[model samples]
Each structure stands twice: as C-alpha cells, then as structure tokens.
Target: MSRTMIAALVLVGLGLLTGCATSKDELMPTNGMTMQELWQQGSSMSAGDAGQQNIAATRATLRRPITSADMVEEQTRYTREAANEIHSQFSRLPNPDLVIYIYPHLAGRDQSVPVPGYSTVFPLYQKPHYAMPGETARPPGRTR
Candidate 1:
C-alpha cells in the first residue's frame, strides 16, 4: 500500500513538471507568422477571435497620435498650476529651499534598462532651511 501511494505521488509530481516544461515553439502561439498572417489566421479561426479583437482594439487605442499643440497646451497648463501651488506653499512656509538634482548618465551602458527586481535610483540628501535667526525648528522624524 505504501509503495502504491509513493508511485501515485511521483506520477502526480511528474504530471505537474511536464505541464510547466514547455518548448519555445509552444510558448509562442504565433510561431513564424507575420502581423498580416496572424490577422488572417485570427479572422479565419473562431477559437481566439474575441481575444484577438480585444488585443487589436487595445493596440489601436495605444497607437493614437498626440498633437504638438495639444502637448504644448497641456505642458503650459501643468506648469502654471504647479507654479501656483508652489507659490501658495511658499507663502505659508517661513523659509523655502529649492534644489534640483541632475543625474548624468553613467560612463557606459544604457540607463533605460532596469536592474531586474531592484531599483537603479540613487539616494537624495536635502538640508532643511531654518526660519528664525537664532532658533532652529526640529527636523521631521523618519517614519516607516
């Protein structure tokens, strides 16, 4: 009975492993088909037509071109709004310090490519400005 149970467990484990171990060909459902071929295949085959249609619609929506005038107008509006907010914030604060950090590209290698499972961002240190001449306000404590 013990041997039969062990064999049954081994067979089940093997079945699970087999399901996960797929070849590249199996992973790529389109195989060697071009865009036109894929469209044609999807149109002919009813199996994945709904999914294909959804993907096509999503791609079409994503490919929409934004006009330069629209982009400039959005940029100007955002800038004005941000400036107004900053002005309001500064008016309330006793002292304000504006600092910008410019990170130059590393000597070699692409900065666009992300380090897998890890952030490529560098640490930022900012010195807080004091309000009074003699008295200094206590720094905000770090919170988890």
Candidate 2:
C-alpha cells in the first residue's frame, strides 16, 4: 500500500476506536441545575402544602381518646409478649452425659450366673442449669 493511504487508514481506525469509548457522564443531558436543585424546583410548593395537610390530619386523629376495648387489647398483647420473653429467657440447657463401664461379674443365689462386660449411659444431672449472661461455657473434664 502507498504511505499516504496507510497513514489515512490508521488515523481513521484510531478515530473510530476513540469515538466508541465514551463515559457515562458524557451521555447524560446537560442542564444548568443539579439533580437536587431540579427536584427542589419541581416540588417546592406542593411538598410543603401536602406535608402540612398530612401533619394536621395525623394530629387530629391522635387527639381522640382510646376506647376500653382498644386498651384491653393492647394490655393483652403486652402481657403475652412479656410471658413469651420470660419463658424464652428461663429455658434450660441439655443435661451433661455420663458413660459407665461395668466389669464382668457373677451373681445369683449360688453365684453361678455369669454377667458379661458391658457399659451404661446416663445423664450427670437430674435438673438442667442454664448459664447467665456474660458467662463463658466451661470445658468438659478429661476422663482416664
């Protein structure tokens, strides 16, 4: 190819590549005001008038006295929630386990009954004890 033609092709390719590589800011419409300023201008009076009307309506509704039924319902809901919290707080942890090994032995009236070697498993505590707040759990003791 001729030198001038090669140079023209390179320049056109570079221009095409640069034109395709555009930023998001360059795609947005240009306005004198920012987003916040535009929103303020559009909602200046309507927002204040609507907010004042809503506040007055809410205040008027809140000024009414509570009925006996409403009071009883609210009290019942509070009492139920309190009872549930107490029950959850006082819930117990699982009991610790105990494993025992029994050696072979003979029994019965004439001492002729032979028992095979076996093991028994049971819980260490009859009642469960839950740890209090801010208390760390204790590690189990090592067994021989």
Candidate 3:
C-alpha cells in the first residue's frame, strides 16, 4: 500500500473510534435520579417481581357495564336485515335455479322397492354474478 492511502485509513479508523466514545456527563440521568439510586432500583428488581395489582386494576377499569348504545350497535351489526344490507351492499345479479325432477323408478335386483320422485336445484351459472353500480336493485321478474 502507498503512504498516503495508509495514513488516510489510520485517520478514518481514529475518527470512527472517537465517534463511538461517550462522556460520563452524557451517561448521567437528567430525571433527578442519581447513579446510586439507579443502582439500588436495579438491584431490587428480581425475576418474581410482577405488577399483579396493576393488571387487576386495568382489567377492572376495562370491564365496565355495557350501555344501551352498545347494545343498539351490536343489534345493528348482527340482525338478519342489517346483515343482508351489509353483505349485499354490492347487489348481486340473480342466477336463476334449474330444478330437475326425477321420476319414481324401481331399483336394486334383490330388493326392488320403488324410489320416490325427488327434485334438485342447481344455479344457472357456476358462480353468482354481481351487478354494476346503479343496476337493477332486485331480480328481473318481480316488482317491489
């Protein structure tokens, strides 16, 4: 290495060491607590030291009786009519159901009892379609 490069590196190392150093005045407490008092407080703190009474007081403060306004808010949040309004704010386009009726027929070779007729329904599309803004409020056919 050259002389100038080595001298510059030494100066930079010394500058970094000085930047990391702290004075005794800066370490002293500004909150009127002396070093001796701080040492005593630190020595008193142990593994079993816990503010259990403080926790109980906080819990008691938070556990105040619920007001009627709170009950009203909860009612609005959970009621079926409000629930539909909340969930269906973006009105969904109606997907008509396709009902297929199965006729009664005999089944099984050994026990050939007649199978009752039944109907099952499936949505017209694979997924429910949603309407755009200002679109029809209700399904196509019905009024009101």
Candidate 4:
C-alpha cells in the first residue's frame, strides 16, 4: 500500500470516529423525571428549581370549577402566557408548522380507558388569534 493512500484512509477513519463520539442525548430531565413527563409538562416553567411545583399547580387548575368570570380570566391568562412561550420557542425551532389531530371516541365511555393511557389518536387544539399590522409581522427568513 502506498503511504498517501494509507494516510488518506487514516484521516477518513478519524473523521468518522469523531462524528460518532458526539452524544445527541446531551439534554436530560432533572430530578429523575422521565422524558415523557417532562415533555408533557408544558412550556410555562419557572426559571428556578420550582419547575416541578409549577407543573403540579397547573394540573390543579385543570380541575377547578369554571364559572363565567373565572373562565374568562383563566383563559385570558393562559392564552397570553401560552402565546409568548410559543413565539419564543418557535422562533428557535426549525419548522413552525403545528400539526394537530383529533380522534373520535364513543359517547359516555370516557372512564373505560386505563390510567395514564391515551385512547384518542388525534387531539383537538384551540388556536389563539394574533393580530399583526402592516409589514411588521413578516415571518423570519423570508422576503416580502
């Protein structure tokens, strides 16, 4: 084997090895929480160690009685926070398209499902309205 050919092969081997040495799983959930749990924890997390606590509090709100006034206020607050978080996150994400699917279910059989099991193949998503005037609301990375 020629010296030039051997050196080229060695360089290619080193490049392949270096690429495989990098870990894609660098980010992991803290406090021993599963990745599934963390993914469903939503985006309104506190900027402190109280993130888990905030998740619990949010879940509690889901069970509260919804009076007219309460519903209005709660929906307003939730919409605002959710929008800000979505904008911030989507700005950094590669694709901004959100695909939502809602599954059909039998009537009056909501309790027959197993615990922590998802029965619906498609879920409903409520979209919030955002108003942008003139060219100020142009999307990123595109020319008008």
Best by lDDT: 3
Q: What are the TM-scores, per candidate, against the unseen true structure? A: 0.25, 0.31, 0.33, 0.24
> Which portions of model 2 show Cα errors greater than 4 Å?
1-87, 131-144
Q: Give candidate 1's error at residue 53 in angstroms.
A: 1.0
lDDT for each residue of candidate 3 in 6-110, tens digit (9 for 90 to 100): 999999999999977977667864587888987878766632236556667779889988999999989876676854653445576678899999999888886
- Model 2, span 1-144: residue lDDT tens: 999999999999999999889975678865667888988877776569788898788998989899999999888755746555544444445577999999999989998999999999999898767656334254432111
What is the per-residue lDDT of model 1 for residues 11-121, given as tens digits with 9 covering 90 to 100? 999999998898777787766788998788867775487978888988999998999998998887557465555433333223344455545543336556533342254
lDDT of 4 by residue, 1-144 (tens): 999999999999999999888765554326777778777675445545597777788999988877899889777755746555555334322223455444543444675554442343332334433433332244653321
Which of candidates 2 and 4 is the stronger one according to TM-score?
Answer: 2
Q: Candidate 4's error at 75, in angstroms?
A: 41
Query: What are the runs in model 4 whose C-alpha is more than 4 Å off?
Result: 27-33, 43-144
Compare the candidates by TM-score and give the number of the best one.
3
Please list the residue runs of candidate 3 whose C-alpha ends up more than 4 Å from where it truly belongs after superposition.
27-32, 35-63, 81-144
Ranking by TM-score: 3, 2, 1, 4
Q: List the residue pairs that clash in candidate 4.
A: 101-122, 101-123, 102-122, 103-122
Any idea how many clashes model 4 has? 4
Clashing pairs in 1: none
Could you tell me the C-alpha RMSD of candidate 4 in Å?
27.4
lDDT of all predictions? 0.60, 0.73, 0.74, 0.58
The CA lDDT at 8 in model 4 is 100
